[model samples]
Target: MPTDTVRYGMISTAKIGINAHIPAAVKSHNSEIVAICSRFDGPAKQAAEENGIGRWYGSYEELLADPDIDAVVNPLPNSMHHEWTIKAAEAGKHILCEKPIAVTMDEVREMTAAAEANGVLLVEAFTHRLNPHMRRARQLVGEGAVGDVRHFEAVLAFTSRDTSTDVRLKPELAGGGLWDAGCYSVSAARFILGGEPVRAAGFAADSGNYGVDTSFSGLLEFPGGAIAHMRSSVEQPGTNMGEVIGTKGKIRIPHLFEEDTPLVITNADGEERVETFAGEPRFVVQFNDFSECVLTGKAPEFPPEDGLANTAAVLALYASASSGQITAVERV
Candidate 1:
C-alpha cells in the first residue's frame, strides 16, 4: 500500500478482464495485475501465466483474503457485478467494475452504499468516456465549438462472432445488445451533454429469435431542449460512431470508442477540420486513473454517482423499449 503502484487482483477471467483489463494494467505505470481469480482453476492459472501475473486463485474469496492485493478488477457478468463488487468493497479493497454497473438502480445503490460503508473506492469502467478523443470532443463542446447542443447521434453495433456460447446472448446472464453495447453509446451521450436525461423512449428488436433484444434504438431527452439518439445492436454490424449536432455547428465523431478516431468539426460557415489525439489506450487511461485515485486517496474524476446516473438512463431506455411507452429517467 505504500508503493506508487496499486496491486490489482482481477476478479474474473471473462473476456473484458482478460482482453482489456489485464493488458491495460500491465501497460499502466501506476497499476499492476499481481493476481487473477476465477471460480475455475484452469482459466485463472492460464490467464495469470499468460499475462505474467504473479499469482492466481481458483476462488474469489481466497484472492480477496490476500493482503498483498491492493484492489480488485471486476469484469464479472452484469448480474454478478453487484454481489462481487459489494464483496470486494466489504473486503476493504477498491474496485474497478465494468459498465452498466448493475442490473437495477437498487443494486447500484446497494453496491455504492457498501463501498462507502467500507471506506473503499468504487469506480465504474467507462471505456468510451475515458477515450482521449471523447475527452477532447467534450472539451470542444464546452468551448462552444459545437455551439449550443441540439441533438446528438451515437451508435455501437456489431454482429456476434459466436452466438452459441457467448454470454452476451444469454438472457439469464442479463445479456442484450443494449446492456452489452448500448451502454457505451449512452455513456458517450451523457458525457458530452453533461446533463442528466429527463425522458427516454426506446424500441428493441429480437432478431434471430434470441429471446432477448439483439438491437435497440433509444431516445434521451435532456434539459434545455437537447436530445440524444443512441443505437446499439449485436445483430447488425456497422460503424460505431457519434456526432454532436448543434444549432450553429456539428462535430462528427467517427467511432467514439476507438483510441485514435479523428474528430471532425464542421462549423456554421461550412468549415471542416479533423482533430486527432495522441495518448494511451482508453483502457490504459481508465486503469491509471483508478490507480491514481487509490494512491492519492482522492475521489475518482467520475465517481459512482455517474455510474448510477448512467445505469438509470440505460434502464429507463430499456424499460421504455419493453413497455412501448416513453419512460422517465430518474433524475440523479
Candidate 2:
C-alpha cells in the first residue's frame, strides 16, 4: 500500500513458494513479500525469515486481512484454488494464482466472475507465457513463421520416487497426472494455438491404486481444424518441452517455461534460426508482471479467462476418457 512498494502475501509456504516464488519476489524491483500464511506456523515463519519477508501469519484469513498487503498469491492445492482466489478477489486484493485454477469448469467460471465483479485483477500464474521466448514465439507464429498452424505437440513429465502422499496422487484433492502435469501440456497447446479447443479425445492411465489418472494422452481440436497431441505422466522421467508445427514451418521451444528459453524458428524459405533471451528467472518474470497488474489496475495478458479455458479442455478430456467418446470442450 505504500507509494514505493508492491506488497505481496503468499497463502502457503509450499515448495513452489519457498524455492521460487518467495525468492523471486525478494529479487523484484517493485515487489516485496511482506507477509506469509500457512496452515502450520513452522514453515511459514521459516520461509518468511529465510526470504526476508516482513511477517508471517498462522492462517490464510489473517494474511488476507492484512491492510498493508496489496496482493495475495495462491499456491494452494488445485481444489483450494477457486476458494482462495475468490476470497482474495472479494478482499479487494489482486490475485496471482497457480494454474489449473480450479479442478472443475464450474468453479473456474465462478472464480473468474468473482474477480471481474470485484474489479480486481486476477491472473493465472502461467509462467511459461511470461517467458520472453514464448512471447516472441507467439509473435513469430502469428507472422506465418509457422505458416497455417496446423498442429501442435507438447509433453510434460517427471519421475517422483517419493512414497509420501501428495495432492498430485489424490483424486479428492483434485490430484491426478492429468490435473497436474497434464494441465501444463494443455495450457501450452492452448497458449500457442491462441484459441479455445472445440473438442478432445483422451485416455487416462489408471494405475489401480488411485482412481484418478496417473498419466494421460490426448488430442485437442482447435477452431480452424488445428490439432494438437499432448502427453503427461507422473510415472515417467523426461524434460519438459513443447513444439508448435504450422503449415509452412515449425518452432521448437526447449526448456519451455524456465529461464533462458532458446527458440528455433523455421520459415518457408528453408532457413532456420534460433533466438535466446539474455537470461531471467522465470518466476521473477511472473511475479513482476503480476505485481504490475495489481499496481496499475491493468488486466493480465494471461487472465483468469485462461484458467477457465484450460480447465474446460482438461475436463473435456477427462470426460472423453470416462465416457469412451469424444467430448466437446466448453468454450470459455
Kindly report which residue stretches of model 1 are placed more than 4 angstroms away from their true locations once superposed.
none
lDDT values for all models: 0.89, 0.83
- Candidate 2 global TM-score: 0.94
Candidate 2 deviant stretches above 4 angstroms: 267-271
Candidate 2 lowest-lDDT run of ten: 158-167
TM-score of each: 0.97, 0.94
The sequence of per-residue lDDT tens digits that candidate 2 reaches over residues 1-332 is 77666888899987887877888887887888889989878988888888888899988998999998898888898889989999998998888888778888788888888988988888878787777877787788777778788878888887656635776887777888888888888988877777789999999986757777878999999988899888988878776888888888889888777668789887778688998786578788777777777777666777777788888899999999899999999876
**Predicted structure with the largest TM-score when compared to the true one:** 1
List pairs with backbone clashes in candidate 1. Answer: none
